[model samples]
Target: MEDKRNIQIIEWEHLDKKKFYVFGVAMTMMIRVSVYPFTLIRTRLQVQKGKSLYHGTFDAFIKILRADGVTGLYRGFLVNTFTLISGQCYVTTYELTRKFVADYSQSNTVKSLVAGGSASLVAQSITVPIDVVSQHLMMQRKGERMGRFQVRGSPEGRGVVAFGQTKDIIRQILRADGLRGFYRGYVASLLTYIPNSAVWWPFYHFYAEQISYLCPTECPHIVFQAVSGPLAAATASVLTNPMDVIRTRVQVEGKSSIILTFRQLMAEEGPWGLMKGLSARIISATPSSIVIVVGYESLKKLSLRPELVDSRHCYQRFTDCYKRLYQLQPEMTQRIYDKFITQLQTSVREEISEIKAEGNLEAVLNALDKIVEDRKDQEEPAWRPSGNPEADLRSALVPYFRQQRDALQRHVRKQEAENRRLAEAVVAGRQQVQELQRRGQARQQAWQALHREQKELVAVLGEPE
Candidate 1:
């Protein structure tokens, strides 16, 4: 429903600062020339009854030529030329939509379906009436023939004898059925085209993505771009041919309604009637798809070279700068290392005083632990300087780190010595106290023995004990 394809086309055309419409329109029309004759023949066959005006594609071709001459094959040329407005609109819209969402969409399939359906929705609304007129004109015989239905717009009574020019058809259609008549098969058209576009885009995108693995370096890959179009078109055409037949029936005046048409086509011509002009449609779609896509992409790429070149050049310059930085001389790298070490020394020297004042030798030890923990996690040898500036810087830093390590070890040793002396004194005092207790206990024991002897002696005298 958001059929915003035109937005992207307008943007893309503006990107190159040139008009893409002219080239796009021309390429599309030219390719259409090859397929138009087939299309006309197919349309004529679709509009007729069970083998009435023509039996099949071969018969249609012969009859048109015999009745209308060389020009008979191009009956709808003028109307189709007018119809190109819608065709171009569809193409532009699709391009714009695809371009608009290219960056955000992860799946090519979804993008394709969305873009295709959206563009068709808009373009079909504008062009179905034109399609009506063209098909009418296409189904018409030449001035010389006599057919069962004496329709207007043709010289003989056999052709679309309702009107002459494009305006005449419009006027006549308006006179007969008014506005609604212009959109006679609106629902059928939507059903036919929406799914057709959705199917076409997904198939196109799927094949394009698969093909892209082969076009790594090119922007509008010539062969890949060209081949991808037809493959995608052919696939979509086959799948949607039945809907197309139904749509054609519903649109052409005097044909049955959609439900009745399907039944009639199936009953009269079999299921094959639903695919009446499949080959012709395929032929019509493929080259036109190719031409439109190739021309659009080619123009886009051609205009983008300068910007791409500039970007690459800027990237190269950045790379060069990095290379020079990495190639700095050993002396310069050593100066850098010295400067770094001086900063570290200053910071640590300031923190050392606070640590010492707080009597937190553990803090210094923790800092040393942290420094060791900061070692690189990778197994690669550090700096790897075989004339590498980074390696040279690492080499210069090694001596400073060793000195710091020695200083921290010295501090740890001092703390350990102080701790050892305190432990010795504590042990000495404990020993002295134990000796005193031992002497006291011995004296008490002696006194108690003497008392017992006396008590025994005095037991006879028992009182003082």
Candidate 2:
């Protein structure tokens, strides 16, 4: 009887940091490896000029496989994997920033948007350089030509020797444009990813909320998240694709500025060029987003502190009861339920702290009694007769409270029975111990008597004749 609406989001404070980081990095690395081929194809598609090298996404994959083999699909995998460091930074910043912003805002959308943007900004400092190098590496295909553009080989006349070494790429970049070459598309990357993150998170939350509401109550929260993630990513990819195109071009093609790249793209390739790699980006992003979101949610669940997991289950059960009570009489019961929940939560938290400090079950019982008494006192006035006879609220509430009371009484009876059984078991254990002790004493006495008998017989035998 679990309620889908009762799904608790594990927050930053509740996480085991060591587990989160270790699992997060491993999951992100696997996701990147899985989707990197599509990324390579997308980058290649974005950088191509008029009279395109490949007709579409499938065509690009086939041509790369035929021309350069499977390695062509993973050209920059090493450089790309290095971005896991930046991924950690992004996740940390996002979680911390979201927690901070949550104190001021009630809207999940606003919190996600701000947190996403801040995280992207922080992550880009590390990621932009890796992106610059990786995108260049992605472009190094043997005998690939796009209209008038041709891929250059090494001075040694070997494409593999030229593109295979990271040092050579760094040296070439240094020789061409100096240190700034490592950050060729710095502004464009920010423009692309910051907004993408900002938009994607809000949309993700929105879609998840909507989908969860529309789906049956038995549907799991993870299902909602799985469906929402790809939709949000596809939307973001399409929205910010022009900037992504510009960023890739600036980094790989060594364009001077974002504006210049845009001007040239428009002049040479027309408005449709803005969406050159749209299909590839969407194709890569959808499955990548699904894996990332699902993995992240699973990581949070796995990384939750042991104590919080119990508390989360307790809270969910409480929420289910609250939902049932609210459904009894929607208008009046809501107010009572809200007030009760607030007071109950506060009382429970205080009682838990006391229990942890003092290890006192009496304090917990007393706290529960006080909460129930206080709620009864507050709700007594509402139970009084209203002016209308047919539209009475009391009729609806009476049965629910009576049902709750019966259930509580049954639970108490069950607990008392269990306690009696435990007491009887303890008494039986003591009796068993006592019986063993008596047997040991009798055996010792018998052994002493036998020794005495043997000594007397020796005496009677006259000292061995």
- TM-score per candidate, chains pooled: 0.57, 0.69
lDDT of 1 by residue, 1-465 (tens): 111110112235334434355665676677668888998877766766667777777777787778667777887677777767887688668767877776677344666678889899988898888888777666556443221122344455444333345566567667777788778788888988898878776666567668766655344455665777889888878888888888887777544378887887788889878878877787778777786567666655444435453443332232232344324442343344447546767988988878889999797799777765676675433333364555654565587678889999999999999999999999999999999999999999999999999988877786655
User: What TM-score, to 2 decimals, does candidate 2 have?
Assistant: 0.69
Candidate number with greatest TM-score: 2
For each candidate, what is the lDDT? 0.68, 0.80
lDDT against true structure, model 2: 0.80
Q: Candidate 2's residue-wise lDDT over 170-236, tens digit each?
A: 7788888899988888989999999999999878877887998899977877788899999999999
Q: How many backbone clashes does candidate 1 have?
A: 12
Model 2: residues >4 Å from true position, as ranges?
143-164, 324-465
- Could you say which candidate leads in lDDT? 2
CA error at residue 251 for candidate 2, angstroms:
0.9
